[model samples]
Target: MQPTKRFDAIIVGARCAGAAAAMLMARQGMRVLALERGAYGSDTLSTHALMRGAVLLLARWGVLQRLVEAGTPAIRRVTFHYGAEAIPVDLSPGDGVDALYAPRRALLDSALVDAAWEAGAEIRHHHTVTALRHDQTGRVAGVVALDEAGREHAIAADLVVGADGAGSAVARLAGANVQEEAGHAATCLFGYFRGLPDTGTHWHYAPGAGAGRIPTNAGRHVVFVSVPQARFKAELRGDRLAALRRMLREDFPDLAETLGDARPDGELLAFAGRKGFLRQAAGPGWALIGDAGYFKDPITAHGITDALRDAALLADVATEGTPAAFVRFATRRDDLSLPLFRVTDEIAGYAWTLEEAKALHLKLNGAMKREFAALTAEVVS
Candidate 1:
């Protein structure tokens, strides 16, 4: 059926990247539609840590205050543990950002969705895209989606954005190629806990394992462990929680001691590990953002930040509504993303010794600094 209504752009996912893009575009007075497959404000598996760049964007877009008002803890300092030596860094006030945060996905994604809706974007929750519709010229012009009631609707738009995630259906439908993929992957097992001491963010690194304790909303901390995928599969078998506990006791004994009697608030979650990739960013009337375009292992915990960064970049050009502008968006996105991607891949490899891991982290820090600088200059200017 032909679409009875049209939009300037239709976003395939309404999480971080898609919702942020829709909000930006709609704020600029473009007609936007965002389709989400999940229930409104539903939670998803995520480390959910926001880097400085992401915080800057959220602040600029007027969404950070909502997160703050929702009682998300402010992360003012971060400690790096290298074989029992702790190096704590206090975040100084700069770039209009005083502190960082780790809001739950339920809160962060819903906040962006609400912001988009308030900015005049049409948001459809529990809507799954079934197929892509193309114009006669073979460029993606719209999509056909199944609503919550199982009714199908064809929607026309000038562009279709793939922000569904690493397993993005829109990217697959659009034949977005995998441009680059990491050779190594790490499995991450994490869970939330209450009553743990809130000490900002703590990252512990040993020879071949990594763990972190991140403070989030409701006075809970997310503690996670990352190990080589092969070891996780061969050693852990089906008992992830036990393995996580053992690792915490053996590799991160200090953190385990701090855990004291703080039992898990929820079930343990696992990302079994998949090779991270950078996919084709844009082609014709379809474009990819967030994990749909570039995904790295959760070991780095920079996924959401990258998603917000690319969403802004894509929206800046996508509003122009032309193929050349999309190409420009891709180029700019790559210029900003490639360095951090390389460092993250190396860290995710889990092939480093304690000293090597420290060096890699330094490199990662440098990359993040450069990213923050670039985003501040461009977005704030």
Candidate 2:
């Protein structure tokens, strides 16, 4: 059967990775198709903070200005609280980068999609990828997607990318192998609040739990709590809001005090810990990026950064469009991701005692320092 429509690439998931990939490839004069199951600009559960690496990529793609113009606040410092002590660290990503930014998912995802559209990529929201389509040679040829009208559509392409997320449909259909995995450690709960006060990005850690607060656009504060899943269940007895409030007051007293008259603006959302893993990112005509290929705990708030990095890296290979390009993309993705994954796993384990937590925190900071120094050396050389 001959397909009616064809593209250079078909990307499932139109959030950060897919949209960015489409934008980059389209800018390079490739015919790209991006599909998203959800409506455009919809919000999802995410840390929302963009690390230095992600910010740099956004700047390169010309989307950072759009985010800032939309009112995302700049986070210039980070304060870590371990028990009764507080340590403030300045966040400078070198090469004159002075601050980090956390924008609401709605704003950020839309910007990426807009960039892709402006670059001449075809985008279809409310389109779900039903399965991967393959040729007789066993290489992927395209995808089976269901459109908004509940009708099935066959879209052919030279390459198919699963930027769909941790539970990626394309990865599953392609049977991508998991090469490395870290076990689940904690449960995460978060909500947005109005009238809350913040001093940059703040983190608090105790024996069995950790919490953080950051200001986003519209002067809203995003607060989160991560605790051992078993302990969280036992303490809450299924009352999530009560458990969240108690976790704040008991484990993060200072952060709780700042709540004052702050009222929650949305329903409290909770997610159980899932092990993070690195999947075989590419095979034949298919490749994966974002949470689809590698996922780490949100404790480090590095998901968006990792996603943007891979999107850019994969886009480069896609531009080359060579037979071995996908394999090279997989190797490069692992080289950059494995170290941060291990570090984040250590921090996400909520079973650590106060002393162990402090030691681990120091180690994490040391790792970041070394990374920054290496970046500086590279730039200088």
Candidate 3:
């Protein structure tokens, strides 16, 4: 690709959203350029539990077949826990969509990006977008990024996408509204553990606390412990494990075993990663997808799955929209993403309540259980 040359789209942030959008657009015969501020998979702090719905996208991209061959764990059941006991809920990948897997995002991110290249998207890593260059009419035109040498380079495109995430520059440029309406997200932190059972997954819910322990490809697992964000103290952030243990034992006792003997590999996963929900997905000549557009509680581990579906929809927009696709893409995102955001917020909030917490166990109705599992499965495959 030539410098200052125009492309069908210029995407910022090459992780999940940008990478998927780039590949999807490229595969659709669009000249796509993806820019990443960080090295492909280095310095990332994610639990890497690729959801079942995301697995479907990888399968469609043929990477799932490769992952299976690579020894990544394929999970087929979910384990729900309250107190000391856990129950496994069986779900099939009928219609060819299996359960879920944890491929170590550090490793899996590279695979997705590489697939983008195979599909013909030009990936430019370590290239951070400094600013968005818009036309006089306030239409997004491209981005100006700084390279390793500190030189300024401009990459122009018809559509400018901001997948930069959380603190999105493109979103700021487009005047996208973030949900400031008392998010009240539960506090959470998770990491990979090497000795947990992988035969089935686990969901341990307790009053104002809970943990989701997922079995990976090997004997490895990733455990997520969520608590009320209000309890997080300035000092607790200084000691992640101690803080984590408190949330586990005091808040949710159901996850004791999974939480016990689990030593963290690093300091902490995220001290304040209450998910962000974007208000828009596209504009006149700009678009946002995946986390750039909407995010749900990773308590369900829906980040990557959101990226997959957003990619599919954006790909269609890139092709059929033939310039008008941006409108339809944004509209579709506006229509589909809000309901998900509202419901997940309710679900996350309930986990922080003792009343709802008690009902998460055997008392949970068939409707709640079915909807819960079905939604998680949908986000994954």
Rank candidates, TM-score, best first: 1, 2, 3
Give one digit per residue, the lDDT tens place, for model 1 in 72-186: 9999999999988999999999989999999999999999999999999999999999899999999999999999999999999999999998999999999999888888889
Q: What is the C-alpha RMSD of each candidate to the true structure, in Å?
A: 1.2, 2.4, 4.1
Instruction: Kindly list the per-residue Cα lDDT of model 3 for residues 1-381, writing each as its tens digit.
Output: 235888988888888778877877888899989988888776465556675556767777777776677688777787666555556678755546766777776666777788889989999888878777778988778888998787899788888888887677778877876643326576677766676656666777766555777765456677677766665544265677776776777756656555577675566675464655655677777777766667666555566766766777777767555556677666656555555555556666754454455443333233333433444454322
Per-residue lDDT value at 91 in model 2:
79
Worst ten in a row by lDDT for model 3 = 360-369
Per-structure clash totals for the candidates: 0, 0, 14
Worst 10 residues of 2 by lDDT: 372-381
Q: Give the C-alpha miss distance for residue 131 in model 2, angstroms.
A: 1.3
Q: What digit string (tens of lDDT, one per residue) describes model 2 on residues 106-167?
A: 89999999999999999999999998888999999999998999988889999999999999
Highest-scoring model, TM-score: 1
Model 1, position 26: C-alpha lDDT score: 93
Off by over 4 Å in 1: 237-239
Candidate achieving higher TM-score, 1 or 2: 1
Q: Highest lDDT: which candidate?
A: 1
lDDT of each: 0.90, 0.84, 0.68
Better of 1 and 3 by lDDT: 1
